[model samples]
Target: MKLTVVGGGSTYTPELVDGFARLRDTLPIEELVLVDPAADRLELVGGLARRIFARQGHTGRIVTTSDLDAGVDGADAVLLQLRVGGQAAREKDETWPLECGCIGQETTGAGGLAKALRTVPVVLDIAERVRRANPRAWIIDFTNPVGIVTRALLRAGHRAVGLCNVAIGFQRKFAALLDTAPAEVHLAHVGLNHLTWETGVRLGGPDGADVLPALLAEHGEAIAADVRLPRPLLESLGVVPSYYLRYYYAHDEVVRELRTKPSRAAEVAAMERELLAMYGDPALDEKPALLAKRGGAFYSEAAVDLAAALLGGGGSPYQVVNTLNRGTLPFLPDDAVIEVQAAVGPDGPVPLPVPALDPLFSGLIANVTAYEDLALDAALRGGRDRVFRALLAHPLIGQYAYADALTDRLVAHNREHLAWA
Candidate 1:
């Protein structure tokens, strides 16, 4: 199979390459293309990718190019990891929102809306080109604000599925804590991308017994600490929440903490420079340990498995993915993209049956889904009012004062990206 990575210049590429190199049997790639306009980073990442493959004794031909159409042409799958405006824009996304006394995050809140506006247009153009190049190719999106991006892709009639490392990372974490293999721990992972909760931790398979309560009783404090939430909160909710939920469950505390620290974007930018320098070394072949601190933990494994399953290679039957709700959650519209366990195949993911949800989680999911609906509107058809309305609708910035201020800042910081501005 020929697989192309559109944002292969990213520092995250090496980790993905490492996964592809390590799991060749799972997604036996014959031709791997790295497509990015940033020629320098692409060259560095591409060279390292080849070395990783050769080091592992894999014979896949690695190609790098700046041409999107040329790179995606005739490819079976394309992975979108592009970051519009790069880390500098992300720095703005993470910092400016904090000025409004909101948590500064790249994938949620006002910043997330800004990213969605900037990203959706670029991704749509790429998807259009990919469709023209190879109509049958599947698009696996690993972009931030994945639900919005995936929604945009599906709405545009692209063959796509959103991928996130959160579920796989949680699976691995829960497995280690439970003294079992990652595949043995099945998370009742639900909700929208980055807004999900592990309602149940089942074992064996989807039909396996739910061990969530027992796991909580045994390792509740550890899991809560790992997620940076209070142990009592987990006990009360009886489900493990995504770490991103901290921006909601502990908004003010998170805002205060965020204000005191250098933005994560800044740290990642510095780390990228260092990593690129390391990538320039001809002798370095394996993915560096520093990449672990760069985030997207287990991204490689998840990508391989998802790609494998989607392409009819080989993967676990029921894995967590972001796809259309299709009535999995009665509260959500069928078109709403939700993250949950599904049986994936060449036809794409078909979500497994999800039991009725508690209103506590369902209410938040519904609220965020509405915000995402508006966010996508603002993304696809730009307007200041629409942006402000989306921000106002967000639970994080429901107050008019913050929403108005955030809308102005978002537009100002991202004027170059927003054609309407």
Candidate 2:
């Protein structure tokens, strides 16, 4: 099978390449294309990708290109990891919302809205191009604001599914704690992307006995540390929240912490520079240890599994993916994109049944789903009013003054990205 990575120039690409190399049995790729408009970075990453594949004795041919249509042409799958405005755009997304006294995250709040606006149109264009090249090719989105982007793709009627590393990361960590294989630890992962909870941890399969309580009883503090939430909070909720939830559960504190530190984008920018320098080394054949610090833990594994499943190469039947909810969650709109465990196959992902949720988690899921609706609205049909409404709707920026100000800051910082502005 052939696979193409749209943002193959990203520093994150090497990790993905490493996974593809390591998991050859699951996804046997004959041709791997790395497509990026940034020619220089693409070559650097592409060279490292080939070396990583070679180091593992995988013979898949690696190709690099600046052309999108050509890169995806005749491919079995197209994976998107692009950043429209690069780290500079992300820095703005990470900084402006903080000025509004709100969380400056890339996937939620005002920052997330700005990212959604900038990303949605670009991703749609790529999806259309991929569809034109190969209508059967599946588009696997690893982009930020994945729910909005994946929903946009589905709305446009593209063959697509969204992938995130959060679930896989949790699976690996939880499995290690449980002293079992990662695949054996099935999470009752629910809610929208980034705003999810593990209601249960079953073994073997979805129907396996739930061992969440025992796991929590023994490793509550460690799990809490990983999520950056207090141990007491985990015990109180009886579930483990994704780290992103920290932004919502403690918005003010997160804003304060963000204000004191350099934006994550800034740190990533520095890391990218070093990573690029390292990539230039011809002798470097493996993903560096420092890349782990760059984040997206287990991203490669997740991508491999999703690609394998979608291409019929073979993968775990059940996976955590972002897809149309249909009616899995009684409260969410049928069209809303939710991140949860699903039965994946060559056709696509069909979300498994989600048990009734607590009002606490369900209420937040409903609220964010509403915000995402507005976020997608502004992204599809840009206007200051629409942007303002999305910010206003976000639980983290509910106050009118903050929403109004954040809208202005978002527009001002992202005017070049927004055609309507």
Candidate 3:
């Protein structure tokens, strides 16, 4: 089977490439294709791919191309990780939302919404190409705002699945924080993309679901103690979820117990600047070589594992992913993309019946969906009016200002992002 990586030059590409190459025997991929609009990035990833194959002694052809159609031809799976307008554009995606004063973190808040608006069209185009070139291929999207983009692709009628490292990574981290292995945990994750709450986590083995709440209550203090570490979802749910908890739980109940101070957003910015410099430096040939050498340990292996389980006749049950709400989330609008359990196979994704959200969780779900609709409208029409309306309608935003004042602030602060599309 052939696999194509849409954004071959991303910093994470070598890791993913190396991961798949290392797992060649299990995944059974016979060829690799790297696609990118940037020639330099294509060469960088292409070179890395060659080195990875050489080390593994695999004989598959490693093809790199700027031609999307050529790269996607006959592909079995396509993984997309593109930054459509690049970092400057991403900066705008984030910064403009923050300028408007709503919780503007990319991936969960207004910033991510802005990104979805601008990125959907590009992803759709890629999906269109994949459909035309390889009708049976599954598109694996690892792009930011994955929830939104995955929905967009599905709406456009493409075979696609959205993958996020945060959820499982959080599950693993929470299990570790509770001094147990990941397999020992049974998690019930719900809600929109990044804003999800686990709602339930139980011991994985014979004891069943009853043991979880007591365990969480018992470990809540210990879990709360690590609050500043990022990935607040697990912590909020009673274990420290992942490295991103600090950002999500900054305003949560036990945040005061955090052992460390959350780093400023500027720190995230600095890291981006460093990555930008690395990408722009002309003397980076040696860098790619070093990266290639460590490629065998790349993070995409988990995804490969999931793929193998689903396709290698392992008969792993269908898993939850992002999809239109419809009946799955009764309180949410039918059009929203919700992450929940579903079956997976050549027939494609099908959502299972998701239980109704408890009142508080349902309200939170509504708030998140309201923002998503706002971002979707903003992105589709390139207008801030819907964006502002979204904020005003948000639980958080509504708590802070009157509708008139909210619109005025949104207009005053987001003048740059709100211009005509």
Candidate 1, 1-421: lDDT as tens digits: 9999999999999999999989999999999999999999999999999999999999999999999889999999999999999999999999999999997899999999999999999999999999999999999999988999999999999999999999999999999988999988989999999899999998999889999999899999899999999999999999999999998999999999989988999999999999999999999999999999999999999999999998998988988999999989998899999999999999999999988899999999999999999999999999999999999999999999999999999999999999999
Candidate 1: which stretches are off by over 4 Å?
none
Q: Looking at model 3, which ten-residue stretch has the lowest summed lDDT?
A: 254-263
lDDT of each: 0.95, 0.93, 0.63
TM-score of candidate 1 on Cα atoms, chains taken together: 0.99
Give all TM-scores, in the order shown: 0.99, 0.99, 0.77
Clash totals for all candidate models: 0, 0, 8
lDDT of 2 by residue, 1-421 (tens): 8999999999999999999999999999999999999999999999999999999999999999998889999999999999989999999988888876888888888889999999999999899899999999999999999999999999999999999999999999999998999989999999888999999999999999999999889999899999999999999999999999999888889889999999999999999999999999999999999999999999999999999988888899999999999999989899999999999998899999999999999999999999999999999999999999998899998989999899889999999999999
What candidate 2 gets wrong by more than 4 Å, as runs, is none
Pairs in clash, predicted candidate 1: none
- Candidate 3: pairs in clash: 230-244, 230-245, 230-246, 231-244, 231-245, 231-246, 232-245, 320-340
Q: Give the TM-score of candidate 2.
A: 0.99
| All-Cα superposition RMSD per candidate | 0.7, 0.8, 5.5
